[model samples]
Target: PAAALDTLARSLPVSPAGSAVAIAQDRAREKAHFVQCGVPVAPHAVIETAAQLAAVPADLLPGILKTARMGYDGKGQVRVATPAELAGAWEQLGRVPCVLEKMLPLAHECSVIVARGRDGTVVHLPVQRNLHRDGILAVTEVYEGNLPPAQTSQALAAAKSVADGLNYVGVLCVEFFVLQEGTLVVNEIAPRPHNSGHYSQNACDVSQFELQVRCMTGLPLVQPRLHSPAIMLNLLGDLWFTGDQPVAPTPPAWDAVLALPGCHLHLYGKVEAKRGRKMGHLNITGTTPEAVRTTALQAAALLGIAPF
Candidate 1:
């Protein structure tokens, strides 16, 4: 079992020292180290006990409480408006080690997924504006024309620096908080193929998953080329019907969508569903971002994902 864990750890894109440290702690120390190395991060502090929370400075109010480990897709997270809320938050988390991060006012959120090969070559994926419902990512829109070139470059540089620092050799994701000032700050990092990169499957020549496989297998990283502007809509469990004899329903009619040029649909082979769970996604590509957005919304609406 230890060998299995070691093999799995070796497959990750982190240095042996960093990986060992990460395996011992609840959170990845490499993330914090990256933030400290000229990468802007959401202001935060680690807390292991109620006393530490009590002693936190007053300026850090309106903060997000997150478990140091095993948190994802909005789970293991809570918001605290004041010190009075800290005790309850810690209790709710079963007294687990956690981090308190200052609440960031975001203009918009985006992510940059990168692939770095063993030779230290890096490739950046297209930037995607993300939409989340109740902390769960639900949709992503790839801006075709109106993207801020400088911010995209900054995001790419930050991702590369992180990867190079860790000697990362696979697909890694760097999420950003696009502030009103047009600055991109590092939000979090995922050292694997991410859900937000799903749009690449239909939108780009190389999907993030494929890139990861290539990197892990020692293949040279391929630059991702966007063929068309695309929009991705996530399918959630709420769309499925609930009954004693539940039948695996087919996706809503794509006749209208297929009629539109460049429309694509993909369904993951998931057997069951629970409320708010990710099921699959629809990617629609078109000549323009607006057209792609419009067609994607229509297709998602037809699939019973309302208010597109």
Candidate 2:
């Protein structure tokens, strides 16, 4: 697809050039790029052959073996606890080129979304605190003080460095892991608007979608300001089922959900509902962080989502 986009960009302008796409598509290249940009990343090895697999360092065990390409939402990944599991994990992945990364102790996960312009100007949304369920994004919280001052500054700087390193020209998301020891390490990158940034739709003056258009059309990119504290809860297809063994899918109590103040729901027009599939998201914004959290919790209770 990058090849096709590269060809198309020859005559028409493209927001994100193919080179950036290529790097984000491969985990090995992504990690290399992060390191080149002076961002810390997890220790890992690329195993494409038996010799390389066998040569993996002992310390890297209890790691995650992930395919270098086409992996998302925890797919194409296997958690290997020891060297003995590496071979089978690789086999399970169909012997594809993979990156084995030492799993680090994490206190929490957060992400930053930056929009870069052709003139090299970069503006970012506030850092987002994220929660993942079953490897899929479950919730995103964005507000002042959601993260510590030092970690916020660090994540913002690293995200900008990555965008500038690629000479990137679009909305890009960089995810990071906050270690228990207060260290920060880059996890991955997404070349377009990300699920974590979805809260910007209602919480910011300029949404990521509009920012993407600006970057593509050579329009001026303005720094987006958060107008209110916000929380976004991902609505998964699992909500469509009620009982433990339901015979048919049932819609949630949207009327009750909408009755809550500051509750905004956006549903994707998917024809079928399957377990683990993303159906929509609920964004709650309010004048105060306390109010937003309370309303969001009530919304979650109504939707059967566990409290944060």
CA RMSD of each candidate after superposition = 3.5, 1.0
* CA lDDT of each prediction against the hidden true structure: 0.76, 0.94
Q: TM-score of each candidate?
A: 0.87, 0.98
Q: Write the per-residue lDDT of candidate 1 for residues 218-266, one digit (tens) a residue.
A: 7877799988788888878766753445577444465765776667767
- Top lDDT: which candidate number? 2
User: Model 2 — TM-score against the truth?
Assistant: 0.98
* Candidate 1 clash pair list: none
Give the Å shift of residue 170 in candidate 1: 0.6
Write one digit per residue (lDDT tens) for candidate 2, span 90-124: 99999999999999999999999999999998999
> In candidate 2, which residue pairs clash?
none
lDDT value, candidate 2, whole model = 0.94
Candidate 1 TM-score to native: 0.87
Where model 1 places Cα greater than 4 Å from the true spot, the runs are 1-3, 8-31, 242-260, 306-308
